[model samples]
Target: MKKAVFLDRDGVINEVLSSRVKFVNKPSQFYLLEGVGEAISLLNLAHIPTFIVTNQGGVGLGFMKESALHNVHKKMIAELAKYGAHIEDIAYCPHKPTAGCVCRKPEAQMLIDLASAHNIDLSGSIMVGDREPDIEAGKKAGCKTVLIGDESDNFAQANIVFPHLLAAVPWILEELH
Candidate 1:
């Protein structure tokens, strides 16, 4: 089985905007955080198939339509391509927190599905994100976890903490080297 490095969209690969007020209802609101492309490129070079698994509850909340989310992802992919990096797959859970959907982060269905579909070895895989649910999901999926942000009460479960993706890249590579 192959290993993968699962990533979160918002905050991990891109900037996180709650969009609670204005709501990122359109593609124009999506922005890539600096250095994300190079960071992902390193993962690719390391022979790790990188997958993006995110919780896009904005669609279920009526803040944005599903199409908008698709468009944003398309834009994200295009941007990444410009830097010569590509993501292997992208998955998302559109249900809001109240819906208690199983596919959302903190649950491992998405990871499990990907592993089953692609023959990924979950034990060697790692999940990197900027939030608590992302870490939980990785753990539940039996993956190593990395939290890219501050390490307060918000990310107690992460195996390693980094300030950003670039900082995390070396450590990820070292794991294999």
Candidate 2:
């Protein structure tokens, strides 16, 4: 099996919006975070397989249609491609937090399912995120977790913490070596 990197989408790859909707419901609302393209480009150049695993509850909650999510992903991919970055796959749980879905963050089902489908070695993989649930899911998936954001009680569960995803790239590459 090959090692890979899994990333959380909202805050890690794109700017987390502070609006009434609070989610990227449309392509226009999706903006890549600073240095995100460069960071993912670095990983791509290293031939590392990268994936995005996110919890997009807005879809299930009827806030946005699935087609809107696809459009947003298309925008994100197009922007990243300009920097030579490529994502192997993108997976999301479109269920509300209270839906008890097994694919949600804090549950390793998404990662595990992706790992199985792609032949990834979860133990050798790294998961990077900006939220506590992200770290928890990575830990549960047996991946080395990196938290990108302010310190929190659950953030302590990560293998390491960084101010942002760009800052964590070097360490992630180092571990892969």
Candidate 3:
């Protein structure tokens, strides 16, 4: 079975504009964090497929159209490609948080679906994100979890914690060996 790395989109792959709002509603608002492209390139070099699993509740809440979200993703993908990095696939939950959708973070439906579709070994895979729900989803899918962001008691459930995605990649690669 192949091993993969699952990543959360917003805070994990891009800079989160918390000062403006929690969600990125437009392509202009989407910006890749420093070193993200390089980290992904390293993962690609290591032959580990990367997948993005995110909850875009902004669509369900009417904050943005699905087309706008697609545009944003296109921009992100293109930018990563410039760095010789590529994401295998992106799975997103476009429902409201209250919609009770199984595909959202903390539910593991998306990860499970991806695992089935790609023949991935969940036990050897890792999920990296900046939120509690991300860790929960990874755990539910039987993946080791890496939490990114400030250290806090809230992230105690994560198998590993780091300040950013770039820092987590080396640890993940080491763990895989």
* Every candidate's CA RMSD: 2.1, 1.6, 1.4
Clashes of each: 0, 0, 0
lDDT tens digits, residue span 29-105, model 2: 88888899999999998989999999999999999998999999999999999888999999999998899989999
Off by over 4 Å in 2: 18-21, 152-156
Model 3, position 130: C-alpha lDDT score = 88
Instruction: Give candidate 1 misplaced runs (Cα > 4 Å).
Output: 18-23
Return the top candidate by lDDT.
2
Better of 1 and 2 by TM-score: 2
Query: lDDT tens digits, residues 17-77, model 1?
Result: 5543234457777777789999988888888899999998888888888998999989999
Cα distance off (Å), candidate 3, residue 31: 0.6
lDDT of 3 by residue, 1-177 (tens): 998999999988997866654568988888888889999999999999899999999999999999999999999999899899999999999999899989998999999999999999998999998899999999999999999887683454899888988898899899776
TM-score per candidate = 0.93, 0.95, 0.95
lDDT of each: 0.85, 0.91, 0.91
Question: Considering lDDT, where higher is better, how would the candidates rank from best to worst?
Answer: 2, 3, 1
Candidate 2 residue-wise lDDT at 28: 86
Q: List the candidate 3 regions with Cα displacement exceeding 4 Å.
A: 19-22
